[model samples]
Target: MTTITTRTVEYPADGLTMTGHLALPAGVGRRPAVLVGPEGPGLSDVERRRADALAELGYVALAFDVHGGRYLDDIEEMLARCMPLLADPDRMRGIGHAALDVLCTEPRTDPGRIAAIGYGTGGAIALELGRDGVDLRAIGTVNALTTGRAGEAARIRCPVWAGVGSEDPIMPPAQRDAFTAEMQAAGVDWRLVVYGGALHAFHHPPVDQAVRPGVGHHPEHARRAWRDVVGLLAECLPVTQ
Candidate 1:
């Protein structure tokens, strides 16, 4: 097993004191970095574990925070806070840039080789960063096929990969089509993968029961999605030992 280190990092975002989790690989040299965005509620064990997994793959990973470290367990509260925030592209960019700034500040991070990936609302934030013209190596989103303002997606300089469950009511087929259309119209390199028979947030583990009506876990799809993103990182941003 590869030895890794983890720590808490405090940063500012969306007018709150945001706290994020950072994980680094075992060795000594600078490495490619990844920004891991959390779901709508906020940063939690799932994203932190993802950072650890990225570290195991020899990259520095930072799991960004939303809601200032608060995880909204109530569906109504989560929607009330995230829905409007997600609708605003500028606010999402603010959150993403704030975390990106922190990641770039780390000496261990190779600023030239960075990628962003997220789940749910976090996924929207990653896409926002791409649209805002950040020089990312890749953008990967799971369970978030959200579309952006029509002309802005042209700023994306890297290939984007989005995954969503076929049965996802939240991000249904129309939404996926719209997202892909926007990407194609902008001439951005992009790919979409629809996991069959899965529901919203299908990549999530079956640890939370307080989910929306159509949300459920498909462990197999979750593993496959992880492998897909890992493969993306390997292709776009390789770290040499």
Candidate 2:
């Protein structure tokens, strides 16, 4: 196994002191960087492990925080904060840009080559960054099929890939259609994969805390989604040896 390094990084975003996880690949020389966004519940060990996995693949990865350093185990509290934030594009962009700035400033990151991959609310932020005209190599989102303001998606300069569970009530067929319609209207390169029989947040591992209705983990689909995102990165942002 390739040796990788990990650290905790503190940065300010959305008026909160965010603590993120940064993972570096072995023997890196300004490697391509990736931004990993957490779900609405906030950053967890799940996201940190993903950053480490990406680092092992020779990419510098940072798993950014959403609720300062706290993880919201209560579903109601998570929605209370995420609902309003999701409705505001500017706020999402601010958070994304803050994390991007930290990633760019890292000595191991190649600023010119970066991709944003996020889950849930974090996924929405990644899409917001694309809509805000960030020069990203690619954008990958899971279970956050949000549509931007009218005609704003045209600002997205990179290809986008999204994954969602077919049975996700939060992102039902109607919502997915709306999101895809917006992407199509903007002429953005986008793809959506619906995992059959999976529920909302299907990619997440089983949690000990009580989850919202229609939120469940599908271990098989979760692995598939990870491979799909990694495949998206390999195709759009190849790492040079």
TM-score of each: 0.98, 0.99
Residue 63 CA displacement from its true place in model 1, Å: 0.4
Superposition TM-score, candidate 2 onto the true structure: 0.99
**Candidate 1 displacement at residue 21 in angstroms:** 0.3
Report the C-alpha lDDT of model 2 over 1-241, residue by residue, as the tens digit: 9999999999999999999999999994999999999999999999999999999999999999999999998878988999999999999999999999999999999999999999999999999999999999999999999998999999999999999999999999999999999999999999999999999999999656675789999999999999999999999999998
- Superposing all C-alpha atoms, what RMSD in Å does each candidate have to the true structure? 0.9, 0.7
In model 2, pairs of residues that clash are none
Q: What lDDT is reached at residue 20 by model 2?
A: 99
**Predicted structure with the largest TM-score when compared to the true one:** 2
Model 1 clash tally? 0
Can you tell me which runs of candidate 1 are displaced by over 4 Å?
none
